[model samples]
Target: MRHDHHGRTHRLELDDQTLREWDCTVVASDPEDGLVLDRSAFYPGGGGQPPDQGVLIWGGVQTRIVGVRPRDDLWLVPDPDDPLPPAGTVVRGAVDDDRRSLLMRTHSGLHVLCGVMARDFGVPVTGGNMEPGVARLDFDLAEVPAGFKDDLTAALNTEVTADRAIQVRVLPRAEAYALGPIVKTATDLLPPDLEDIRLVDVVGLDLQADGGTHVASTKQIGRIEVAKVENKGRGFRRIRLRIAD
Candidate 1:
C-alpha cells in the first residue's frame, strides 16, 4: 500500500516552502535508498529529471545524498562510504530545492513538447531527459522538412506561453493499463503492478503512466526552443531544446 500526493490534493505549497514535507522522524534505513516515508511529496526521479538530493540528519550526524535512485517498487538512498545510523533512527530528510525545481520545470516542458507534437504532427516520444538547462527527446519520424525545426520551436513556445497545468497521480495499475499499453520503447519502465500505476497528464495535452516530479503549470517552464535535432538512426530523430524566458 503506497501512494504519492497529487490528484487527491491541490495547491502544492511545498513549492514556496523550499521543502517537500521534510520532517525529523525515526525510519528503518534500508540498503536501498527507497525511503519508506510515512509520506513523501518528493518524486523518486523517474521519467527523467534525475534523482533528488537532500540531507538526512540524525542527532549530530549528517548524511549527504549520495544517490537517490528508484528501484522498481522502492526509492533507495545508499550510503556506500559511511554507514547510516541503525534502522529506526530518527532523522531529518531535506530535498535539494534548486535541483528539484529545475527538474520539475524541465520535466513538464518535455510533456508539453510531447503533447504539442502529438496534437499537431502526430509525434510520440521514444526517449527524453530533463537536464538542467537543456532537454532532449527522441522522436520517431522520417523526412523532417527544412522548416520543421522552426515550426516545432514556435509551436512549443506557444504552449509554454499558454501555461497549461501538469498533473501527476497514482492510479490503480489495472486502471492505468486499461488506458493503453506502454509504448514499446517505454515498456521496460512499466510498473510491475499493473493494478497500481502512476499517471502524468499534461492537462489538455498529453497523459501517460509516469513516476516523475513536474511543475504545477507550464508557465513555470518559461519558454522553450529547439536547440538542435540530430539524426540518430534510420527512423529515430533526437531533439534538443533550451528553456528560455
Candidate 2:
C-alpha cells in the first residue's frame, strides 16, 4: 500500500531515448520497501511496451531493479532482499541498452506496419503489443488481401530501406483529435482530463497518439520478417513480426 504523492516523476526517456544512464535524487522510499525517484528513464510498461529492466548504483552498492509500476507516480521495485535507499540519496540509474534498443526498433517497426496497412489496404489497428525483439498487431479486416503476407513483408522492408525519420511531439488534445483518420483509436479512448497528447509520427507514413518509446528512424529497424498472420475472428486479423539480425 503506497500513498499518492503530489509530485510527478519526470520521465527522462521520453525526450531522449538514447540516454542509458542518469543520476537522480531519491524522492521517496522505505528501507526494505518500495522506491520512487525524482526522475526516471524506466518505461513503466504502458501502451504495449514492456517495462524497462536495469540496475541502480548508490554508495558503491548496486541493486538489481526487478520491476516498476505506475501509480500516481512511478514506483521503482527493487529486489526485496536488498535494502532500499532513503529519500535524498543520489543514485546512478542505467537502462539495459541492448534491451531498450531492441524494443525501440520493434515499436517503430509496428508503426511502419500500421502505415503500410492504412496506405495500401485502408485498415486500422485494433490492438498491439511488443517485447524486446518481437511484436504483434491486430488489424480490423474482414479478410486478408491476396498475397497479403508477402506483400506486407515487402512493404515493411521498403520503408526500412527508405530510412524514414520518425518524429515525436506533444500537441493539444483538440488539435490531435482534429487529425481525424490519422489517429488509430476512437476519441473517447483518450483520457478526458488529458489536455495534451504525445504523438509519434513515422514521417509521411503514419501518425497516432502514443506514449511508448521508439527509434529515431525507420532504418534502425533493419530487416523485418512477417513471422505469422492469423485470423483471430470475424473482422480481426493478427500479424506477428520479428527483427532479423
Q: For residues 1-245, could you state the per-residue lDDT of candidate 1 as single tens digits?
A: 33533322221222332455455443345654534443344445656667676667777877766454444433436456655666566666677787777777777778887777678767667888777668998888776888989999888888877878777666676677677643424235665655567677777777876666778888888888889989999778998988775
Off by over 4 Å in 1: 4-21, 24-26, 30-42, 69-83, 173-192
Q: How does residue 17 of candidate 1 score in lDDT?
A: 24
TM-score of predicted model 2?
A: 0.93
Best-matching candidate per lDDT: 2
lDDT of 2 at 78: 89
Assess candidate 2 and give its lDDT. Answer: 0.84
Candidate 1: lDDT of 184? 25
Worst 10 residues of 1 by lDDT: 6-15
- Scored against the true structure, residue 143 in model 2 reaches a CA lDDT of 84
lDDT of 2 by residue, 1-245 (tens): 11112146778888888889999988888654478888788877887899898888999898778778777768888887776778899999999888989999999999999889888878778888888889999988888878889989999999999999999988787898787654674233676787778889999899988888999899999899999999999999999999996
